[model samples]
Target: MKVLLYAEATRLISKSGIGTAYRHQIEALSRVGVDFTQDWEDVYDIAHVNTVGPGAKNVVRHCKNKGIPVIWHVHTTPEDIKNSFVFSNFYAKLSRRSLTRKYAQADHLIFPTQYTESVIRRHGVKVPGTVISNGVDTQIFRQNLCKAREFRERFSLNGPIVLGVGFPFKRKGIQDFVEVASKMKDVTFIWFGAKILALLPKDIRRILRDPPQNMIFPGFIPQEELIGAYSAADIFFFPSYEENEGIVVLEALSCECPVVVRDIPVYKGWLENGVNCLKGRSNDEFEQIIRTLLKDRDLSEKIATNGRMVALERDLSVIGDSLLKTYEAVLGRCRS
Candidate 1:
């Protein structure tokens, strides 16, 4: 069946996790031979909108009026948006009310994680919902020895590397990353993502300007380069306070890199503290976990191997099959 897939501010979201998710979903759908269009005006069986913006709301309204089933992919909520960037907390307050109204227009709602589904439900979203991971392309993100070597030589990196991928935002635990870096001078910490320095809060800007010597901000690298970074790194450390689903974690896991993430509820079933990956609830715990991983090769390898298995389970091919089922289920419900 043909579908209309729309995401508002696609250009602006290209550097964000939401953009990566949208691209992965599109790729998965195509792999399953699902006919879809990005054009809002295109005639289709389903309208899958990925944002809660005015344009997306309008599309949902139009689809509802036309007797078309609409799938609203919930990518962001007010809680996750708070403290993300300058003045985001203020916008988050307004976003909560706006999301409630927009979500009501959907025939079905899709959440990347069960935690997100609960969050939306708590916000009074009464629509039927399901959880589906925004899966990873394992082929593109897998380990490559040659690319890893190239990345090390290009950056003149030495010692065990610790990598974090995402925009430099406060809610992403940028401050905690920097603090951890200061205590570990021997380790090279690289944060691979884009950030608008001017738009960041003054305190955050100050820290970014005079970051720890061990910390390197390689703003927005290409996919090939990113895969190399993931492969080359000894540990992937993500301390982000919020996430619908940490897609980059899956990418790192796909590359067979052991990860240490903040002990957040979003990773409840997806990540285990000592099974697939380590979890740290504080700066001290994070530092200790990283050190333990660096010193113990066996433990690191074991976790990395398990993590890769988890990634494989959520690979795009599998996700494609699940998505098709969800779509077909939605269509069946519409018919009934």
Candidate 2:
């Protein structure tokens, strides 16, 4: 069936997780051979709205008036937005009320993770919802020795590389990553994303100003380069405080790179510490995990293999069927 897939501020967020998710949705729909359009004015069967911006609210209302079923994908919640950007906590306070009203307008809601679904539910969003992952395209993100070698040479990077991907937001644990990097001076640490200097808080700006000699903030890279980076990294050390579903994590896992993430509620059921990947609560814990994986070849290989399997399950090809079903179910309910 035909669908209208829309996301506001695509240019602004194209390097962020939300934009990655929007791209994944488009890829997933296309893989399932579902006809879709990005334009809101286009004639379509359903409207799948990804952003919570003013234009998004307008699109949802327009769809509703036309009796078109609208799927609101909850990419950002009030709690997740609090520690991000300058004055973000204040924005979060305003967003709670705004999100509650905007979310209520949808025919159904789509959450990237169960943790996110629960968070919005606590905010009193009673709209029926389903947990659908922001899946990865395994074909593009898989392991590649040639690309990995090229990435290291291009960046002038050496062995035992530790990598983190995403914007330098406080909520993403950039401070913690830097602190952990400081403790490990021998190994090279690279963070592959950037944010406007003016938008970041003073503390974050200060840290970025004088990062450890071993640590490198190379700013955002293209997807092809990112896939190479993931393939080259020895450990995908993401110390994020919160995430609906981290697309970078999936990309790392898909590349068969072992990961070390913070012990957060968002990874509760899926990420078991010492199983598919390691989890740390503090900088000390994160540093220790990285050292262990670096020295212990068996442990690293096991986690990498297991993590790749996990990514395969959430691959775009598999996720496409789920999206097709969800779309059909929503349309069927509307018909009944």
Candidate 3:
């Protein structure tokens, strides 16, 4: 099928999960040899969009004018707007609401998670939508590409490493991540996140400005180098307060790294605590669990093995078929 996929920023090609998802979806279609473009004369059969802003809005208008099918992939929620955009700019939530109306008007709705579907549903903007969990390149990430000792020396990493990923923002519960790092004395805490300087409160900004001796912040790493980062860590730690299916969790699992994720509903569905992954709800629990996992190498390895198995079966090629089915369903509905 012909598709015109539009996104907010292709910069996500180098950083962050939403950008990563956009890149993956386009790549998946490209691998299957689908036609897509901006212009209408050579016209697209479907126009797939991501975030609800200038690009998505403009793409939808163009596609609708040409009588082509349109799909709005809802990757961000209302809460993300409050956290990422200031009051002045967050007025786009109103525009975002209008975009949800576009979803209601579109030939189809594409969402990364059911949680996202539920959010838009609650907003009284109901239309046909399907859930496609974010994807991972399982085969590429499963192997250990970097030698541990030399890699550790290059980055000056010391002790059992605990990694904190996702953008550094309040919604990511970064303060909670910092609290976890502060409590753990022996482990070196590492953060690979975006620089959200303007959004943070003053003290939180200063505390993270220099970062502590124990805390390591690698500003931004491209998608190509992320596997090396995962290979370097003993466990991937994420405690996001708000996540519509954390794709980084899948990426970490793809690397055969054990994970400690928040006990959020979306994560709870895929990750079985203490069996396939470790999960926590409270700060005390998050700390104790991290310490216990650090000491238990055998348990961690077993969990990592299970997590890799899960990522392969759930997040890779299997998801491609599921996505295809969703597209087919949308097309079928449109025919009626």
* Candidate lDDT values, in order: 0.91, 0.91, 0.74
Residue 21 displacement in candidate 1 (angstroms): 1.0
Regions of model 3 farther than 4 Å from truth: 12-14, 38-42, 85-96, 145-147
In candidate 3, which residue pairs get closer than 3 Å at backbone N, Cα or C atoms, i.e. clash? none
User: Candidate 1 residues 109-228, lDDT tens each?
Assistant: 999999999999998999998899999998888989999999999999868999999888888899999999999999999998886987789988898788899999878899999999
RMSD of each: 0.9, 0.9, 2.5
Worst 10 residues of 1 by lDDT: 51-60
Model 2 C-alpha lDDT per residue in residues 44-129, reported as the tens digit of each score: 99999999988898998899899999999999899889888989999999989999989988989999899999999998989888
C-alpha TM-scores of all predictions: 0.98, 0.98, 0.90
Query: Pairing residues by index, what is the TM-score of model 3?
Result: 0.90
Tell me the lDDT of model 3 at 91: 55
Model 3: per-residue Cα lDDT at residue 173: 71
Error of 2 at 114 (Å): 0.7
